[model samples]
Target: MKSKDNFEAVLFDCDGVLVDSEPLTLGTLRDMLAEHGWSMPLAECTRLFLGRMVRSQSALIEAHTGQPLTDAWMHAFYARRDAALHAHLQAMPGALAAVQAAHAATSGRIACASGADRGKVELQLHKVSLMPWFEGRIFSGHELPASKPAPDVYLAAAAHLQRAPERCLVIEDTTVGVTAGKAAGATVWALCSQGDADAQHALRECGADAVFGSMLELPGLLTPPR
Candidate 1:
């Protein structure tokens, strides 16, 4: 994971890394919680849950509400989420170009490791026409023993791609994911275009190897710094 090393693979965190769907999800969650008389600012919502799994979010909410959410409630929430995602989803700016460049640079060893469920991951990638790039290489945090901030999923991705963890490169947009990538010994870069200073600092503290504000900067980062 050294800056001078040539990476064998590039692993992406799907939600914020590939698609600009975090805001849509944040808005949807905010509205859903408002119905239950829970008020939270959008910033706090993103800070708490952007790169987390549904199961974790459910547990947190249940802990706060002092009650467990039923399957029916989760089902309904996801149904609404699907609609919102379908309506607002778009690829991250320059994302396709960045992915293509990274794939070519790594000789086609790119995979998506996301905190989202496989279904949602596939749907969002397909909606943005990014499915072809990741076809059989999609991985979900839901399948891991523990989610982001844990290295299991990223490590799994490196193993499946037949690459050593230290030779893998990871692109993430959250401190949670950066922590996981660092844990797995992959070099990580945090994309913080949508975030403020605190977000940048968090990514650094979590072990991001570099930080940039845009996807447009990715191709440059993928290459060894001269």
Candidate 2:
């Protein structure tokens, strides 16, 4: 396992880590999928799409809906998802405090590396008033050649911060994201904010260097930037 001390930067996953927007996004997706004749519970929808890019599931979506996952359909999903987020998205409890702590400990060397589209990530951050902390430091996997589970996004964020991936601390909320951070050679901490014991076990099994149950616990876990 990688040591957590003397990290040069903190790289955060945007969805479940910073913003409490997963349910809103997944609810919209579940509704839209139902409209397309592929009805499923939000839990199932989340199980299928959380921590991964939506479009990457095109094959399964197409097979279930008996329709092509076209660009227009994606745009429609984006529109609906954004509206729902704008209306109800909130920052995860204690996220602001954690971000402030990260900023101070890392000396402002922090970035939001997200698996979602740039537009969607930006919109959610803005809606929840987190845009100021992330702004130009946000790296969207959708803008890269690959997204989560591929390590491209975290690698890009670490590169932009001029830090070695191994010297960065990655905070993620899902196994797919933890996999990506580990693949990028970073020390990853999984946020198990919902107190899900199974999720904590899964995250540890997926190679998270540590697991935390709240953003409130983050500051204590970090050391001064290298």
Candidate 3:
């Protein structure tokens, strides 16, 4: 009884969409960058790194600090970030309900595709008790040839789900993630948890097919096939 509104699979992004880990992640990164002489406000740090891998910003970091981005520095960042998230991370509001609805609607065909390191993604999901829903289906862009703003991770998740990208629904929170989902040919829906009109507009302009505030709205939006 599949209908136009139903998708064969539902793919989700990890940070802002499933767990409220962005602030912690960006905050840790901001403090670390300050130690390296690249201090900036939290908002500026977020604008620079949201939906992007820290390693991917090596050139920018080098440019600002006159120092190479080293593995030791990255490990330190990961260690601090993971500790913070393990202590304070929580699932986004209604995230479990949204995930449940997607799982049921697609008969368990769902995955988490994120532009983060595997360890970070797994740790956050585990801390928030969301690991079971994704488990082996978690796809990390850091493990692929390219990350978000590229189609690699979403495409990989869709392939693992044994579904065509066109038949998948990608739920993302950032414009970078939306672009990746759209590039993968999925129907991209953005979760604008902040309820910011500018974010909604930016997501749409970045190729999101739809944008809505609150994860609670997702279950209704993903209407079951009649």
Candidate 4:
């Protein structure tokens, strides 16, 4: 594998990569579904929700249940989930250190690209004290025409950073995110924070350049020359 030499910026995906909020989000969704007489297994919930935005996830649920997920349902779900997230979210292991190291190494060129809305991303980052590392550097799929599995979000993040697509590196934890990054012409490093072996293998098959179990291993991949 050839080492990357000209990567001037690092882009991150928020939910699984920066904060370990997937479990909370998935649990909240399951609980909400249960209120409507729908019960989803934890594994199935995780598979369905991983890397997908709330609106899209709701659409999927609508398709499955033959019931329209109305705006009221979405609003209520987000209100409850946001509160839970505020109370429980935490930075993923080594995530803060990795962001800091990357920022220091690149002179403040690290950015986050998330499937979450801007407010939710900001709130979680602030709660975990990781907001400062991303000052003025967060982009959301809400601002794009499409979310993960499409190149819009990553492409927007690259454009916001004023870096060429090939000059950026994307850190992602889902197959959809990896595909998006590659589609945007960025190299991807997949983190196995949410899924199992099969999922990790699928991410690589989709387009990840490498995969790691934790962000602690990222520094070596970005180690600067002496």
> What is each predicted model's overall lDDT from 0 to 1?
0.86, 0.91, 0.92, 0.86
Alpha-carbon TM-score of each model against the true structure: 0.94, 0.95, 0.96, 0.94
Locate the minimum summed-lDDT window of 10 residues in model 4.
Answer: 1-10
lDDT tens readout by residue for model 2, 1-226: 2334878899999999999989999999999999999999999999999987888999999999999999999999998888888888899988998898889878999999999988988888888788899889999898899888999999999999999999999999999999999999999999998788898999999999998888877877774344
Deviation in Å, model 1, residue 188 alpha carbon = 0.7
147 Cα displacement, candidate 2 (Å): 0.6
- Separately for all candidates shown, the number of backbone clashes (residues 3 or more apart, or on different chains) is 0, 0, 0, 0
Deviation in Å, model 1, residue 125 alpha carbon: 0.4
RMSD of every prediction: 1.9, 2.2, 2.0, 1.8
**Residue 222 error for model 1, in Å?**
1.8
Candidate 1 residues 72-118, lDDT tens each?
A: 87787788888999988999998999899889889999999987788
What's the C-alpha lDDT at position 48 in model 3? 89
Name the candidate that leads on TM-score.
3
Assess candidate 1 and give its TM-score to the true structure.
0.94
lDDT of 1 at 70: 80
Model 1's alpha-carbon lDDT is: 0.86
In model 2, which range of ten residues has the least summed lDDT?
A: 217-226
Q: Please, what are the lDDT tens digits per residue for candidate 4 over residues 26-46?
A: 899889887786788988887
